[model samples]
Target: MVAFHASALDGVARNPALPTPLLLRLLAFDGGGDGPPRYAPQRAGLPESAVAVILAHPNPGARVDFAMSKLAEPAQRARLVDDPSPKVRAALAYGPEWGDPRASVALPDDVCARLLDDPDPSVRTALLDSPHLAPSFVASLATHHDPAARQVAARAWEKLAPDERLALLTDPDPEVRRVAALGQCRRDAHLTAELLRDPQFAAEALRRGLLHRADAERHVAERTHLAALAENPSLPADLVERLAVDPDEGVRLAVSLRPELDETRRMAIDFTVGDLDRGDGVHWVREGLADPEVLRRAATSAHPLLRRSAARSPHLPPDLLHLLARVEDPVVENRLGIHHPDTPEEVLMRVYARLGGTFSAWMAETHPRFPREGLAARYADHPDGNYRRLAVRDPAATPTLIERLSHDPTVWTRQAAVGDPRLPLHRLREALHVPELASSAGANPALPEDEMAAVLNRAGVPA
Candidate 1:
């Protein structure tokens, strides 16, 4: 499909090994059929690489396209770029890395400016990675309102000055903040410390209303900023003391886990540990009780959570747990059961799964009132693969339940039966061998095409 002018070639003959039809068609406007032959490339004789490069090079001048692909020297690349073909310019603007220093640096300033706003994403990506681009110019582009442009700009923003860095930090867009926070700002001790020290930094960050989707995300940002300061073990003692008593559980949790916790800070931790709102206070107290005296003091507290936390601690006396086991508050009892699922099998099975503890033994045991049928159904039908797998292994599980699950519409449910205890070996073999069921079983969650084929292979079913 290579275009050859009848007049340009010594004798006209189609080259069977010519470039693709599209490339030929792209050249047709210049020479083939009734078109003028002035633009034909035979004047220079097309290079071997030119033909291969032009095959995928969008319709335009071959030289510029090759230059854009970085197939030529920087001088050659710069020369061909002036070709009066927007297609060529577009390709050069967005083309693959040429690695030619001049290709990035020698680009006309106007063209470089235009490339910043290029509609094609590839062109913008190429421009962003261009080492020749000035930092100031790149910074201007990085603050672009367009997300794709901004994202490209972020990659370039890594080399910006501290003042410019602050500009991006305070960018109006959350995407900008998120990328900045996670990528660049995360490594800046000065920036992160400044954010932690500034009383209005969190408020300003929150007010800018970037990525405040959840309380946890806010907590994470706050924690990240605080951690930036906490990493400095020589952090001011007053700052450490204030943070130790911070109302946020995450902050207190940070304090509790901080290696810097000393006697004065330990007293602060004790006070903070006593504050229930500071995230599972009992947890901190129990974990804090690596000191035997602390455990003893915590064990005698009137608060049940503290006492239960004390009982659950490996360092605490086992006799303390026996004493609390008789107190009768269901909440505390549930915690004890949850914490000691292996130690107190009888009481653990008595509590509900929703109350939060290992439920394998509970599922195996038949409760007189609620019965196991619904829970069994959830186990077989649950979206989570692990839960379903666990459910199928229970002794209370029956063949009927396994069969229902084996043919269930959902692949996860059906696959659950492969390792199920209730399904007989023959049933498993049959399920694996049946082409339709087996194909469905092994099919990719996205494409179901040879879905049946894939499932059969996985289930040992014949294609």
Candidate 2:
């Protein structure tokens, strides 16, 4: 049999008139050592019986290869749509040829219907891309149980009937409704009003002009709706002003931070210390508070939480920051350490002198103008490992100081020394045998390429 198949291959290669089934059988055989058969027939030229034989091949690879080939008849491709193999169906569904409307023109309605109910979501999704799919069938898949299918249907939203689009507005899937709301609800005021009741769709509706002033007035009464409404940039100034004091601190805080608020409106908006208790509200208010006076008041408020909130404000005056620095509160101290750029130099020096024992390491590593020289000199022999590490990383660190730090008992200090640009290659070479320092030493640009290559090669690593 093997000899016969081998001879058939040579004959088919020599003559084009050989039967395609014989050519396909030879191609499907796994010629272990004799090398693969050479007869390759184009799908369009293959007989229907030959195409069927390829599709029926037990190996999915053979079926996929054939499905991916060009077929002369849509019916031939349609026959495999219900082949009980999801992968086979998927290949036909997503094939580029099906993207052209003419390729699906001869496909029977029963075949298109079976593809719509295909168990694989990907097959259903790819079916939606077929230009010849009926509008009614596309609409049916719009609410298909699979969110992925509905997501595809949402892209064809404009082609769906008005009622079909409305049905999807409340589809169980949030993503499906979100897509539908953005595409279909913009022009229908009634549908827009209905979607506004759902917080997920409210903001999009308002931004698209689907929600009018009356809709905003009616929906603003609901707190859930207020969050989305607060983000709408086009809300009337008067309505925004009304919402600025909507009794819900969330609403007030949202309104206060809107960039659309003019100077007078922003200044007029009020937030009590209680508003700072809501973590999210305070975060947004702190980020948006531009009024120096409000920030100053919050900075000096008797309530520590309120003061902490104010201290976090990026817009706080440098003078207020200096004042807040002296409060001795950990929260206030940490905030000051991070926002120290605008603080007065004298205040920074004073804070460094007073709390240098506690925050010196962090300040040295992070502060732009941190007294690197002062800290290095002051903490050169500090007992704290972090302080020692910071000293090694400081710009004032001498090569000798780094060399001494390289021999520190702590691995962290050794790791820090490995990263220091001033560490001599000789010192790095000494540390290479230490497994912990290998990665850092290997990455150092100062290490000679040839030396690093030799070190990595000795460690059984590719250079």
Please name the candidate that would achieve the greatest lDDT relative to the true structure. Answer: 2
List model 2 lDDT by residue over 66-131, tens digit each.
Answer: 554544366666677867678778766654343221133334556766876887877776676655
Candidate 1 C-alpha lDDT tens digits along 282-401: 434644645676666556555445565555554445665666656654554554543442334445444544443344234323223223334575576677654564455456778777
lDDT of 2: 0.60
461 Cα displacement, candidate 2 (Å): 4.0
Q: How many backbone collisions does model 1 have?
A: 7
| Cα lDDT for residue 398, candidate 1 | 84
Decoy 2 TM-score against native: 0.41
Candidate 1 error regions (>4 Å)? 1-64, 67-87, 96-110, 119-140, 143-145, 183-463
Residue 40 in model 1: shift from native, Å?
10
